[model samples]
Target: MKTLKLILIFCLLFLFTLSFAQTKGSFKVIVHKSNSNSSLNKVEISKLFLKKTTRWKGSKQKVEPVDLVDTSPVRENFSTEIHNKKVGAIKAYWQKLIFSGRRVPPPEKKTDIDVLKYVHENTGAIGYVSNSANLKNYDVKILKVE
Candidate 1:
Protein backbone atom coordinates (compact mmCIF):
# COMPACT_ATOMS: atom_id res chain seq x y z
CA MET A 1 0.00 0.00 0.00
CA LYS A 2 2.88 2.40 0.76
CA THR A 3 4.51 1.60 -2.60
CA LEU A 4 1.26 2.29 -4.36
CA LYS A 5 0.92 5.58 -2.53
CA LEU A 6 4.47 6.61 -3.56
CA ILE A 7 3.79 5.71 -7.18
CA LEU A 8 0.57 7.72 -7.17
CA ILE A 9 2.40 10.73 -5.69
CA PHE A 10 5.10 10.50 -8.38
CA CYS A 11 2.51 10.33 -11.11
CA LEU A 12 0.71 13.38 -9.77
CA LEU A 13 3.94 15.36 -9.62
CA PHE A 14 4.87 14.37 -13.15
CA LEU A 15 1.52 15.41 -14.47
CA PHE A 16 1.69 18.73 -12.64
CA THR A 17 5.11 19.46 -14.06
CA LEU A 18 3.97 18.66 -17.53
CA SER A 19 0.95 20.86 -17.14
CA PHE A 20 2.99 23.91 -16.08
CA ALA A 21 5.82 23.48 -18.54
CA GLN A 22 6.31 26.39 -20.87
CA THR A 23 4.63 25.78 -24.18
CA LYS A 24 6.75 25.13 -27.25
CA GLY A 25 7.25 28.19 -29.43
CA SER A 26 5.55 30.36 -26.85
CA PHE A 27 5.73 34.15 -27.09
CA LYS A 28 4.14 37.19 -25.48
CA VAL A 29 2.90 40.29 -27.19
CA ILE A 30 3.45 43.61 -25.35
CA VAL A 31 2.31 47.14 -25.95
CA HIS A 32 2.81 50.46 -24.28
CA LYS A 33 0.80 50.92 -21.12
CA SER A 34 -0.92 53.88 -22.69
CA ASN A 35 -2.48 51.71 -25.36
CA SER A 36 -5.08 50.19 -23.00
CA ASN A 37 -5.36 46.91 -24.90
CA SER A 38 -5.84 44.26 -22.24
CA SER A 39 -5.80 41.30 -24.64
CA LEU A 40 -5.46 40.46 -28.28
CA ASN A 41 -5.88 37.07 -29.87
CA LYS A 42 -3.74 35.58 -32.61
CA VAL A 43 -5.78 36.99 -35.49
CA GLU A 44 -5.74 40.57 -34.20
CA ILE A 45 -2.03 40.36 -33.46
CA SER A 46 -1.29 38.83 -36.86
CA LYS A 47 -3.25 41.54 -38.58
CA LEU A 48 -1.53 44.28 -36.59
CA PHE A 49 1.95 42.91 -37.10
CA LEU A 50 1.28 42.29 -40.75
CA LYS A 51 0.10 45.91 -41.09
CA LYS A 52 -3.30 44.69 -42.19
CA THR A 53 -4.83 46.80 -39.39
CA THR A 54 -3.62 50.31 -38.71
CA ARG A 55 -5.30 51.44 -35.51
CA TRP A 56 -6.18 50.16 -32.10
CA LYS A 57 -9.91 49.59 -31.74
CA GLY A 58 -9.88 50.91 -28.20
CA SER A 59 -8.66 54.50 -28.62
CA LYS A 60 -8.36 54.66 -32.40
CA GLN A 61 -4.65 55.14 -31.87
CA LYS A 62 -2.54 54.22 -34.87
CA VAL A 63 -0.83 50.90 -34.42
CA GLU A 64 2.93 50.93 -34.68
CA PRO A 65 4.04 47.34 -34.68
CA VAL A 66 7.66 46.54 -33.95
CA ASP A 67 9.68 43.41 -34.57
CA LEU A 68 12.68 41.74 -33.05
CA VAL A 69 15.55 40.93 -35.36
CA ASP A 70 14.76 38.07 -37.72
CA THR A 71 17.46 35.92 -36.14
CA SER A 72 16.01 35.94 -32.62
CA PRO A 73 14.28 32.78 -31.48
CA VAL A 74 11.43 34.83 -30.07
CA ARG A 75 10.93 36.38 -33.48
CA GLU A 76 10.97 32.95 -35.10
CA ASN A 77 8.47 31.59 -32.58
CA PHE A 78 6.28 34.64 -32.95
CA SER A 79 6.41 34.32 -36.71
CA THR A 80 5.34 30.72 -36.45
CA GLU A 81 2.68 31.01 -33.76
CA ILE A 82 1.20 34.36 -34.71
CA HIS A 83 1.68 34.38 -38.44
CA ASN A 84 1.51 30.62 -38.97
CA LYS A 85 4.52 31.00 -41.23
CA LYS A 86 8.26 30.61 -41.08
CA VAL A 87 10.50 33.65 -40.82
CA GLY A 88 11.55 33.31 -44.42
CA ALA A 89 7.95 33.07 -45.51
CA ILE A 90 7.07 36.20 -43.57
CA LYS A 91 10.00 37.95 -45.20
CA ALA A 92 8.74 36.93 -48.59
CA TYR A 93 5.30 38.20 -47.78
CA TRP A 94 6.76 41.53 -46.73
CA GLN A 95 8.80 41.67 -49.90
CA LYS A 96 5.72 41.18 -51.98
CA LEU A 97 3.92 43.88 -50.05
CA ILE A 98 6.81 46.26 -50.45
CA PHE A 99 7.04 45.63 -54.17
CA SER A 100 3.36 46.11 -54.57
CA GLY A 101 3.66 49.43 -52.68
CA ARG A 102 1.02 48.26 -50.28
CA ARG A 103 2.80 48.34 -46.91
CA VAL A 104 6.08 48.64 -45.13
CA PRO A 105 7.25 46.19 -42.53
CA PRO A 106 7.74 47.13 -38.88
CA PRO A 107 11.13 48.32 -37.77
CA GLU A 108 13.31 45.53 -36.36
CA LYS A 109 14.96 46.03 -32.99
CA LYS A 110 18.20 44.38 -32.03
CA THR A 111 17.13 43.00 -28.66
CA ASP A 112 14.20 42.60 -26.30
CA ILE A 113 15.30 45.64 -24.32
CA ASP A 114 15.32 47.72 -27.46
CA VAL A 115 11.90 46.51 -28.45
CA LEU A 116 10.65 47.26 -24.96
CA LYS A 117 12.14 50.74 -25.09
CA TYR A 118 10.46 51.46 -28.38
CA VAL A 119 7.15 50.23 -27.12
CA HIS A 120 7.54 52.15 -23.87
CA GLU A 121 8.23 55.39 -25.69
CA ASN A 122 5.65 55.08 -28.43
CA THR A 123 2.01 54.99 -27.39
CA GLY A 124 0.93 53.14 -30.50
CA ALA A 125 3.79 50.67 -30.61
CA ILE A 126 3.30 46.93 -30.04
CA GLY A 127 5.90 44.18 -29.97
CA TYR A 128 6.60 40.65 -28.76
CA VAL A 129 9.12 38.94 -26.53
CA SER A 130 9.93 35.47 -25.23
CA ASN A 131 7.85 33.90 -22.48
CA SER A 132 10.82 33.89 -20.12
CA ALA A 133 11.38 37.62 -20.29
CA ASN A 134 11.35 39.49 -16.96
CA LEU A 135 9.05 42.37 -17.58
CA LYS A 136 8.67 43.32 -13.95
CA ASN A 137 10.58 46.56 -14.29
CA TYR A 138 9.10 47.58 -17.60
CA ASP A 139 6.17 49.91 -18.21
CA VAL A 140 4.71 47.83 -21.00
CA LYS A 141 1.44 45.92 -21.01
CA ILE A 142 1.36 42.28 -22.08
CA LEU A 143 -1.58 41.40 -24.25
CA LYS A 144 -2.96 37.90 -23.89
CA VAL A 145 -3.26 35.72 -26.95
CA GLU A 146 -6.10 33.24 -26.82
Candidate 2:
Protein backbone atom coordinates (compact mmCIF):
# COMPACT_ATOMS: atom_id res chain seq x y z
CA MET A 1 0.00 0.00 0.00
CA LYS A 2 2.84 2.43 0.80
CA THR A 3 4.50 1.76 -2.53
CA LEU A 4 1.26 2.39 -4.34
CA LYS A 5 0.79 5.66 -2.44
CA LEU A 6 4.31 6.78 -3.28
CA ILE A 7 3.75 5.96 -6.96
CA LEU A 8 0.56 8.01 -7.02
CA ILE A 9 2.33 10.95 -5.44
CA PHE A 10 5.10 10.76 -7.97
CA CYS A 11 2.61 10.77 -10.81
CA LEU A 12 0.87 13.82 -9.41
CA LEU A 13 4.14 15.65 -9.02
CA PHE A 14 5.10 14.89 -12.60
CA LEU A 15 1.79 16.21 -13.87
CA PHE A 16 2.12 19.36 -11.81
CA THR A 17 5.61 20.02 -13.15
CA LEU A 18 4.39 19.71 -16.73
CA SER A 19 1.56 22.13 -16.17
CA PHE A 20 3.93 24.60 -14.54
CA ALA A 21 6.32 24.49 -17.48
CA GLN A 22 3.44 25.07 -19.88
CA THR A 23 2.30 28.11 -17.99
CA LYS A 24 5.81 29.45 -17.56
CA GLY A 25 7.20 29.13 -21.08
CA SER A 26 8.05 32.55 -22.42
CA PHE A 27 7.02 33.96 -25.83
CA LYS A 28 7.92 36.97 -27.90
CA VAL A 29 6.10 38.92 -30.60
CA ILE A 30 8.54 39.86 -33.32
CA VAL A 31 8.73 41.89 -36.51
CA HIS A 32 11.31 42.70 -39.10
CA LYS A 33 13.78 45.51 -38.48
CA SER A 34 12.13 47.63 -41.13
CA ASN A 35 8.83 47.82 -39.28
CA SER A 36 8.44 51.31 -37.96
CA ASN A 37 6.57 50.35 -34.81
CA SER A 38 8.71 48.72 -32.14
CA SER A 39 5.93 47.51 -29.88
CA LEU A 40 2.20 46.90 -29.82
CA ASN A 41 -0.34 46.05 -27.15
CA LYS A 42 -2.01 42.68 -26.91
CA VAL A 43 -5.20 43.95 -28.46
CA GLU A 44 -3.43 45.16 -31.60
CA ILE A 45 -1.40 41.99 -31.89
CA SER A 46 -4.54 39.96 -31.35
CA LYS A 47 -6.22 41.84 -34.14
CA LEU A 48 -3.39 41.02 -36.47
CA PHE A 49 -3.56 37.31 -35.68
CA LEU A 50 -7.35 37.22 -35.93
CA LYS A 51 -7.27 38.81 -39.36
CA LYS A 52 -8.97 41.89 -38.00
CA THR A 53 -5.86 43.91 -38.74
CA THR A 54 -4.56 42.47 -41.96
CA ARG A 55 -1.83 44.81 -42.97
CA TRP A 56 0.88 47.01 -41.60
CA LYS A 57 0.76 50.23 -43.60
CA GLY A 58 4.19 51.39 -44.59
CA SER A 59 5.21 54.55 -46.39
CA LYS A 60 4.09 52.87 -49.61
CA GLN A 61 3.30 49.23 -48.85
CA LYS A 62 1.41 46.80 -46.61
CA VAL A 63 2.83 44.21 -44.25
CA GLU A 64 1.52 40.69 -43.70
CA PRO A 65 1.51 38.39 -40.63
CA VAL A 66 3.19 35.07 -40.02
CA ASP A 67 2.12 32.44 -37.50
CA LEU A 68 3.40 29.31 -35.83
CA VAL A 69 1.82 25.92 -36.35
CA ASP A 70 -1.54 25.46 -34.67
CA THR A 71 -0.32 22.59 -32.51
CA SER A 72 2.72 24.35 -31.15
CA PRO A 73 2.74 24.92 -27.38
CA VAL A 74 4.11 28.42 -27.87
CA ARG A 75 1.24 29.17 -30.20
CA GLU A 76 -1.18 27.87 -27.62
CA ASN A 77 0.28 30.13 -24.97
CA PHE A 78 0.17 33.10 -27.33
CA SER A 79 -3.45 32.47 -28.18
CA THR A 80 -4.41 32.18 -24.55
CA GLU A 81 -2.44 35.17 -23.37
CA ILE A 82 -2.85 37.54 -26.30
CA HIS A 83 -6.13 36.48 -27.91
CA ASN A 84 -7.81 35.59 -24.62
CA LYS A 85 -8.97 32.36 -26.22
CA LYS A 86 -7.86 28.80 -26.72
CA VAL A 87 -6.29 27.52 -29.91
CA GLY A 88 -9.38 25.50 -30.80
CA ALA A 89 -11.58 28.56 -30.54
CA ILE A 90 -9.21 30.54 -32.70
CA LYS A 91 -9.24 27.81 -35.30
CA ALA A 92 -13.02 27.74 -35.23
CA TYR A 93 -13.13 31.47 -35.76
CA TRP A 94 -10.87 31.14 -38.76
CA GLN A 95 -12.96 28.31 -40.16
CA LYS A 96 -16.09 30.37 -39.95
CA LEU A 97 -14.40 33.37 -41.44
CA ILE A 98 -13.00 31.36 -44.31
CA PHE A 99 -16.33 29.67 -44.95
CA SER A 100 -18.01 33.02 -45.22
CA GLY A 101 -15.21 34.31 -47.45
CA ARG A 102 -14.76 37.19 -45.11
CA ARG A 103 -11.15 36.55 -44.06
CA VAL A 104 -8.01 34.56 -44.58
CA PRO A 105 -5.66 33.39 -41.86
CA PRO A 106 -2.02 34.40 -41.76
CA PRO A 107 0.68 32.16 -43.15
CA GLU A 108 1.76 29.49 -40.66
CA LYS A 109 5.15 27.86 -40.22
CA LYS A 110 6.04 24.68 -38.34
CA THR A 111 9.03 25.99 -36.42
CA ASP A 112 10.25 29.11 -34.66
CA ILE A 113 13.11 29.40 -37.14
CA ASP A 114 10.65 29.40 -40.04
CA VAL A 115 8.62 32.12 -38.41
CA LEU A 116 11.70 34.22 -37.74
CA LYS A 117 12.93 33.70 -41.28
CA TYR A 118 9.60 34.79 -42.71
CA VAL A 119 9.55 37.95 -40.61
CA HIS A 120 13.21 38.66 -41.29
CA GLU A 121 12.91 38.35 -45.05
CA ASN A 122 9.66 40.30 -45.31
CA THR A 123 9.86 43.89 -44.22
CA GLY A 124 6.13 44.04 -43.74
CA ALA A 125 5.72 40.85 -41.80
CA ILE A 126 5.26 40.24 -38.07
CA GLY A 127 5.43 36.97 -36.16
CA TYR A 128 5.93 35.31 -32.77
CA VAL A 129 8.20 32.61 -31.41
CA SER A 130 9.57 31.10 -28.24
CA ASN A 131 11.58 33.64 -26.29
CA SER A 132 14.64 31.44 -26.16
CA ALA A 133 14.89 31.06 -29.93
CA ASN A 134 18.24 31.95 -31.53
CA LEU A 135 17.32 35.36 -32.93
CA LYS A 136 20.83 36.85 -32.71
CA ASN A 137 21.69 36.22 -36.36
CA TYR A 138 18.36 37.36 -37.80
CA ASP A 139 17.17 40.83 -38.63
CA VAL A 140 14.11 40.21 -36.47
CA LYS A 141 13.17 42.52 -33.64
CA ILE A 142 11.08 41.76 -30.61
CA LEU A 143 7.89 43.75 -30.16
CA LYS A 144 7.13 44.55 -26.58
CA VAL A 145 3.57 43.98 -25.46
CA GLU A 146 2.06 47.01 -23.91
Residue 139 alpha-carbon offset, candidate 1, angstroms: 2.1
The C-alpha TM-scores of every prediction are 0.81, 0.80
Pairs that collide, model 2: none
Every candidate's lDDT: 0.88, 0.86
Write model 1 residue lDDT over 79-130, tens digit each, in one string.
8888999999999999999999999999999888888888888989999877
At residue 127, what lDDT does model 2 achieve?
A: 89
The number of the candidate with the highest TM-score is: 1
Which is the leading candidate under lDDT? 1
How does model 1 fare in lDDT?
0.88
